[model samples]
Target: MVFSNNDEGLINKKLPKELLLRIFSFLDIVTLCRCAQISKAWNILALDGSNWQRIDLFNFQTDVEGRVVENISKRCGGFLRKLSLRGCIGVGDSSLKTFAQNCRNIEHLNLNGCTKITDSTCYSLSRFCSKLKHLDLTSCVSITNSSLKGISEGCRHLEYLNLSWCDQITKDGVEALVRGCRGLRALLLRGCTQLEDEALKHIQNYCHELVSLNLQSCSRVTDDGVVQLCRGCPRLQALCLSGCGSLTDASLTALALNCPRLQILEAARCSHLTDAGFTLLARNCHDLEKMDLEECILITDRTLTQLSIHCPKLQALVSQLLVVDLPLRDERCPATLPHYRRNLLSGRVSSIILGFRGLLVGLTWEVENLRVTVFVFGCEPNTGTQVLTQIHGQPVE
Candidate 1:
């Protein structure tokens, strides 16, 4: 068949330089570099500073010295907007400093899993990337309160900050961050066990614009701290308290009452939480889109059903509560069963199902008549009973 003019143009060898460069942007650095060697035009566009805005040198092996980063930054010129060096074991403080100095326009920087990065590197980043708005230092073990001081002093425009698993950061560092970066909207301190009530209190006091806060694994934070946070940041859309062992039902209840705009809440591993906490969430926070109650032993079908009824927008849920125990009257029961099944099939659900035998052993008056069996499965197509199964005397698959 004869091709139309448009089709001919598509198959034409000659293409506009801008279009070719735009296409090159989608290619990986290695592939782009290889294409650059094919022709002069490709080389010009590939090496152009405009196309080098986001540099992902993750896992790129090089010498421990600053030569690799320095060379890359120098070659990319000053147009680098985002620099992600995650899992780059070869890079140290010297290399990071070199990049920071050259890429002053960088807005998003991820040094996650970079264990070699010390406070000195973070300090250098604050000094160099004054315009940086997003910084992810997750798993950067060397960063301390001193680094926060530097970050607060320099990166005042920061909007998003993730220091998850940074064990060194204490209340002092968090306070400094809150005091310095008033514009910060999202803060993830998951696994920062050293963080306490004082740090969250500072966030509530200074970071009024905060939209998302994650304090998962921060065992030191108590109900008082969460109460303070909910009372202060009313506009908060997302709040994560997974593994925060000290948090009780009262804190969640207060949060539900206070944070009406809360869209996402993750209270996984919060052993202190009970049905009362979920009831509070159901009564309020109707806009919730995501909730995680994994390992919350106190949560039953009753709370899950209540959450489904209240939070129609809920799209994600991670919980240990059995679907079979939830009252069928709950509108969310059908939806939740499917979600649970999907998570189970995908291996995303981390909590183990406590056997009926274990429950029977734990209960004082439980007899043979008590039917308790937990089946982990994704929701079947068009069938709401994704979590249902018949237990017989003999084991059957």
Candidate 2:
């Protein structure tokens, strides 16, 4: 046990190179690449082909609003495996084509919000990157259905696809895509308004491996489409229908009953949703972790309380009712009620209440079952001075 400092240094040098490479995997692509500039030995290790299996160019902060693809291509040529360029708005069609041509080995590619990309870029990507398994084109507004045909022909191994907000794509494009990419595990089409029930029907017939589907803001999709999707994709683990106005309780009920493994649901703006829909959700989808029902006016306190009781793992719940409410009271109410209400008022509530009416008579009332504080205001008389009153209710406002 009398090891010297020199012996310890020699033992450290004897460490396996595979162990050093494993440690490099945890470091971000930028930091790992930066290590290359430290010393010759570090540069050789960092620039090794195996070390470039997953490359993220999103860290290029200099001139962030400008194209960085050329710099990326020059720095990590032909070695990228997983590339994510989310929010890189400066990347145009040419830059994307260049990146695709060079990084043909990429398996996971996320280009979300890269607005400058168009249909031609997809064609270029298809021509080069044939090994792509995961592709996220969310919010790429300029991309059209023609790109789907190219992607289907090029990337045969694509397993996960996200085309959310690509409004230019219609049922024809989606049908072609589903038919071509049979192994797709996750498909996200949120905000794709042009996609109707026909697309889901096609998907049901084809992509059986789909485990997650996000149809948020797809206004044209009705319960009929979701029924078909649930019946086909039996292993679906998560579904997001936030802002899908056409979906009713029937669709959600069917999904809850059939898709037993469904865990996360986002039905934030489904205006037609009622307590019955939520009840079905609580009973069937017992493993649900997060649910967003923010603007669903029909969601009373009963539904929320039931959700809390049944879904014990529920971590985040967003509801507009939990924020603020307004209450109107009669002028004949006793002054004693106002004293109790005044004590409950907060500075944020006072500012909003003052803008409504000049005066208000405080009163307490129950809406559903949750407690809420309300503000009351009234217009002024001949003197042009308004009156104000604040009220707190034991139930939801």
Candidate 3:
């Protein structure tokens, strides 16, 4: 393994440029920058555009300036396919305009948390980057419908878009987006409170290929909108209705009747849902894997029993409750007692939660193939809240 001076100098001189680039490819941005300062030949190998195809500057987001991005874009040019500038708050439209012009072949771009960017960036991207597939503009609050319009006019190949926390978005913007990006498979619209029934209607009309739709906190949408959406977008597999207070059992019934392939249903804080709605959902959506029923006060033991009986694929059920009665319980056990209380105290369970609030406690355990997690909340305790979790009968921390 010992290298003599002749052997050491000969290896670098004899190695092919392709092999040197291959070795440089394994180095990260900081190391490559250091390598560029070693010597002239190392500088050429380090700065070669082919070795900088996919760069993630998230670790140095605070230090990454506009000039750094511009230089990287110029260096990589058409060879760059993915670039993530997530949390780079200093990045603005001018730098991204240069980036779009240079990196025309880029497919996946993560601009999440880039608060300084605006519609101009989207305009630049649409004008150049037609191969764009996944774009995350999460929390880019400054851009409004103009950005959506720009994206709709171009970027027809977009598949996954996350506009979470973009409060300026309205129905018109959503309509324009769905009309153009008809192939959208996953769209996250969380906290876009301006969106109403019309936005969902637009999604139902054009985005039939949608598999995951997160409409969390879009409280303006009603059951009628959800019904129409469910009927139109039957390919939906994961849906989030959390904080959509206007939704009722009618929405659940619509999902059960039309979206049978539903796998993940996050209905947390949807207070109107009752056992009757969940019973119907369980019977039809047999492939259901995870369900979040937290804060759903109306659902009782009947809903749990129905799910345990019908939805065999159910893996996780999150609810806030003091009691549950599943059909799998022995008939000899008292009906007044919860189905898992005996096993929970006997240490036969795989997992356990000892505390949540003094008034109500949540115990989660895995039995055979079923994994249930119940989370309950009550008034703040005088002694403060403490959570102790145990896995395989051993306390964790």
Top candidate by lDDT: 3
Pitting candidate 1 against candidate 3, the one with the higher TM-score is 3
Which sequence of candidate numbers ranks them by TM-score, best first? Answer: 3, 1, 2
Backbone clash total for model 2 is: 8
Model 1 C-alpha lDDT per residue in residues 281-385, reported as the tens digit of each score: 877988887777778887776775676567666666666643433223334444533433332332222333321211210101111332223343333224343
TM-scores of all predicted structures:
0.78, 0.71, 0.83
> Model 1 segments beyond 4 Å from truth?
1-23, 39-42, 59-65, 326-397
Candidate 2, residues 314-371: lDDT per residue as tens digits? 5555554432323323334346444444333322221121221243323223334323
The lDDT of model 3 is: 0.82
In candidate 3, which residue ranges exceed 4 Å CA deviation?
1-8, 326-397
- Over 238-319, each residue of candidate 3 has an lDDT whose tens digit, in order, gives 9999999978899999999999999999998999999889999999999888888888888776786787667767666677
lDDT of 2: 0.72
- Sort by lDDT, best first: 3, 1, 2
